[model samples]
Target: MPRTALIVIDMLNTYTHEDAEALVPSVHEALPGIAALLKLARASESPVVYVNDNFGEWRSHHGEILRAALQGRHPDLVEPVAPDENALFVVKARHSIFFETPLAYLLGQLGAERLVLCGQVTEQCVLYSALDAHIRHFDVVVAADAVAHIDAQLAEAALRMMSRNMSAAICSADGITFDARRAD
Candidate 1:
């Protein structure tokens, strides 16, 4: 059986970037789904990994980042999907979670052969992360409703690329099942 992991990417953002305002609505819509998936991931004994952007804070830790984001422009986005004590946290400097991070090693340690990706900027970070996961030979299952984007059109295109080129399974968050007995 394939071991599955949930990767929540870049949702701890401050939303202070140039394109942040435009993406707020979509991010708001995705919050509930992300939260629900987080609950499901925890209940099933599956690993819940948060791959967050460090935002150039060399000295920043996960708790510091979470606190900052909670006090940042949009706390609603960060607060709902905040990482818990049991969730594994990996800070990344770039778009891909595997870039400059120990994500691959952590996944290896957890024996995660399949990944359920959920988070912000569907056209950018989420897309790149999915590609990297695919290249690493991991089965990718993107929680479509749990991902937000800056541009709707580009986000759609990115989803298509993930489905066509990378063979990622795109489905709603509620449809995602982490049951260990079933084949992913």
Candidate 2:
């Protein structure tokens, strides 16, 4: 049986960017769902991969990156869905998690055929990552309520594109089932 991996994208944020003002509220709304998904993934012993932006801090590793985000203005946003010790961490410099990253190789090594995606910037990182995941032939599932966005309209359009163009499963976080024995 193929394993299901939970991909948490760009959730480790500092909230110091120019668009942070517009993005924070959306993150607030999406937090509970993201948190719930994390809990479920962890409980099920499924692979939990956190693909986060490096924020131009090229010198930082995963722990340093996480530390910086936690020390940022909105630590509240980073706390709930923070990566646990067992979670896999991938630092990305661009929007798509797979771009110039070892995520594809890592996923293949873990035997993750189905990916449950959740996290911030729904129209940007999440959207692009979904497309990349689609082309890679991984079964993509986007937790609608678990993704945050900078623009509501663009986010909705992105979700539509993922569903229509990429054939990604768009559903609530609660709608997801994590059993590796059951095909999604």
Candidate 3:
């Protein structure tokens, strides 16, 4: 049995950064797909983990981060895909979710073998996370329509890299499936 987990990365953003001008629209576009995937994951009893960037706010926790994002730039965008009570959150200081975070230990405890990744900055955080997951021998799946990037070209290239190098499954949200039997 291969336990699968949904890794929602950096989607709890305020979109107030310098790159937000180029990134916010794509993030907004990806919202529906992300929400759909979340619904499906929950209904199937799959673990939904949110791997968010701490943005150097060392004192802030997950709740604080969410609150700040809701008050920041794009509340409309942040409101739709906000983390629910059931979601597990891990805060990372760097682009990669596994970096300086309890994500690896947490996923191991969850018995996650396959990771379905969705969320913001496809070329940056998502890309790095996929590579790290691959190195750790976890099956990687990138929800294509569920991820947003600052630049389309770079994102496409990153996806190609993930597919060719990490052998990640690149597909739309509809292609994902959550099975309760997959985990212990």
Candidate 4:
């Protein structure tokens, strides 16, 4: 086995905020499971990648994003939680994280052969990332409970497609355990 990473996409509370313009129910419920995966990644020392969109705006850097999300008034459109020092943030302009981001290079440097993708909008970014990882010959695991979509039916269907069509392992967050020694 090779190195693995825990990818949490768009878990920002901004998307889940009670007054978010784009709030989705599936993502809201995904928080607990996302939290569980976050805990696991932190506990296991596995690298955590946050694939967040620039909200098609901001026109800012990562630091500015943090500032706006955490301190900007006017109900900023971002989750107000600070990421850990080791956690890496990738701001994506398109729906796909791998489209033009450093994600490929980061994963290569991390020696990550398996990417555990869990986050919001099962049919969009999360789906794109998972499929990209699989096509790239990376082991892709999609945590069912840790991800959500506005349409539960589509989310469920997407999971099936990922598992049966793309060879993704759809497991629960609690069932996942990262082995650092295995990375060696």
lDDT of 3 by residue, 99-144 (tens): 8889999999998899999998899999999999999999999999
Give the candidate number with the greatest lDDT: 2
RMSD of candidate 3 to true structure, Å: 1.2
In model 1, pairs of residues that clash are none
Q: Clashing residue pairs, candidate 3?
A: none
User: When superposed on Cα atoms, how far off is each prediction in RMSD?
Assistant: 2.3, 2.3, 1.2, 3.4
Candidate 1 has its poorest 10 consecutive residues by lDDT at 175-184
Model 4 over residues 58-124: C-alpha lDDT tens digits? 6766666665555533233235224677889888877677888898899898888888998777887
**Candidate 3 lDDT for residue 69:** 91
Between 1 and 4, whose lDDT is larger? 1
After superposing candidate 1 on the true structure, give the runs of residues whose Cα lies further than 4 Å from its correct spot.
Answer: 180-184
* Candidate 4 Cα errors over 4 Å, as ranges: 16-23, 70-82, 181-184
lDDT of 2: 0.93
After TM-score superposition, the amount by which residue 124's alpha carbon in candidate 4 deviates from its true location, in angstroms, is: 1.1
Worst 10 residues of 4 by lDDT: 72-81
lDDT of 3: 0.91
